[model samples]
Target: METVRPVETWLTDMDGVLVHEEDAIPGASDFIEALKASGKKFLVLTNNSIFTPRDLRARLLGSGIDVPEESIWTSALATADFLADQRPGGTAYVVGEAGMTTALHEIGYVMTERDPDYVVLGETRTYSFEAITKAIRLIEAGSRFIATNPDPSGPSPQGTLPATGSVAALISTATGRQPYYIGKPNPLMMRSALNRLEAHSETTVMIGDRMDTDIISGLEAGIRTVLVTTGSTRPDMIDTFPYRPTRVVDSVADLVELARAGSGEM
Candidate 1:
């Protein structure tokens, strides 16, 4: 196969790529350092919306991956950005966690449960009937539905917890309205990351473990993609799937080596 051009920016998945269930992946810290050393810009674009961006950054740092606070972007942030463009100053009835409220509020979206213009969903450990009922009521009042991502469950050391998608499903089932997701596998996230780097698809490479979300987003965004085997995307499943990544490595360490070798640093 012909060699692809060197990567200028990396749009990476957060949960499984950098840390899984709050534990930093092996060599994740060094991977960040290598990218910084190569003058490459990277951001953790994750579907998780349980924590604010600042909080997530602190969590990652505590786990040994030292990434800049602003270098992190969550589905909550992307959802807010998308809403800002579509419904500036609109009242949003949020059905998620602190992350969703923080982001929507920061973007000037008013929080309201009465006659809201939008229903925003994010990750939440507690998915009570009252929250879903309120969202359904707003939908019945003609509120547009929006969601962070389609991750049905979150991975953790303990077990998988129902994610935002599950809540979105409840609202959808109750009101017959499907939400617009602003996370992985959606171009909204890819666009947000690109805007941050001010770069084009030709020079950007997406690195992730999931084919459905990460690689699909990258291909849709018209960028090269590399899949690593350290997370949800199992090794035996890669060849069986119709989707393909530009390259597949064993870990983040190999990702760094691949980038450096392409740039003549290896």
Candidate 2:
């Protein structure tokens, strides 16, 4: 194999690798600081499309992660990017929260209920029956279907709640039109992030917790992947996956030294 170059850009999953719920994982703050001080391009990625980057930044700050708004990327943003590329200035019937809507609006997409070009599905706390029904009808009436991510359920203080994938399934059953998902493990999300950063796969690293979504997507994108055990996938579960990440570690804390070394801080 050719010698792997030093990492010049980084793509990291936000929820599990950096913060879990409202709490920052240990050393997550230092990791972010290291990435910033390295002067290397990096993006914090998340599949949740409920909040805008600004909102996520505030939330991370509350958790003491201190991730900048510009360094954050979401499924909503990736979906919007895909749509904008597929059909510039298109019209869509959106069934999502501020994150999805804001991204679409920023991309010059018009959200409408009648005669739309696409029916875009995204994650939201509240999934209104009326909105879903409208999406089904619009899709049945010839509008294309699109979704942010394929996560079937999301965590809540109460419990697991049906997410975008579950709703997309319902709509697909009703309309017989499967949505084109734009998040991991689609690889499109990773490629889009790489493109956004103008980074090459040979010199980019992806740090994530999930072997299925994050690791798979990074692998597909040809980026080196690091599996951290701070989130969904435990260390013992790593061997269960057919494909493996380039490296595995206990947590972001374990990689802080590597990050610092990359920045010439050693």
Candidate 3:
């Protein structure tokens, strides 16, 4: 077990940790404000690559959380950041939506529909057989493969539906080349969040609802992780999962209480 030290930063999940289906979670806003007031650095780390950072920031503000557009970090942003870092001027064959294209474009990437240097996959509602075929061809022609996240499904009013990871898997199957995933569970996004915080992994804690992404990223980075039950952290899977968080709290309120107790602030 990694010894708990003075926390300098926090990487938080947005969907289940901060809000649930557009409805902000109780204590989320206040807790965030508290973190800010305490001068603790944090970022809203989300896997929803469907929306760009500006859109997501607006959504969060609309939900009543004091989220800055600049403080928001999505899988799209992570992918864009990664691409920019790896190959700034590389041409990309994007199979996602406005978020993917716009982010890449802003990072000075050249976007094309054919014979690109990279094949980047994200949540695309307009999945066509033609697009998949094109991606396969590009991969075979030696295009670098990249994926936003590994989540198979996303929560919706109708129920779970295919996410970006599903499409990325399809491309991987076709090309026999594994993709570099940029979202939670992958340290890529966490590294981006740490950069945003001007902090390193060792002094930061990753708090999220899902163990697969949040806890896994923390483990990979050798940091503390906190699982919140109010989000996607399932009950039955805790003990069974290979990675375990340092603590689990029921809600943001509970998290504050727990933190206070640990720091003798209560």
The prediction achieving the highest lDDT against the true structure is 2
lDDT of 3 by residue, 1-266 (tens): 95556777777888888899888999898877777666667788888777887888778888998877777888898998888888878899988888888889888999886678889888866788898889889999989988888898888888888888888888888889988888888887888888767897777777888888888887787777888888777877799897688888887766664333333221
Clashes of each: 0, 0, 1
lDDT tens digits, residue span 1-266, model 1: 95665677878888778887778899788888877777777788888888898898889989998888788889898999899988798898887889999998998989988788888888888877888888888888898888999988877678877887877887788888999999998977998889977988887888899998999899888888889899899989998778799888888877766555445321
Write out the backbone clash pairs for model 2: none
Q: Which pairs of residues collide in model 3?
A: 185-213
Best by TM-score: 2
Candidates sorted by TM-score, best first? 2, 1, 3
Candidate 2 stretches greater than 4 Å from native:
263-266
TM-score of each: 0.94, 0.97, 0.91
Better of 1 and 2 by lDDT: 2
Question: Which candidate, 1 or 2, has the higher TM-score?
Answer: 2
- Residue 10 lDDT, candidate 3, scale 0-100: 72
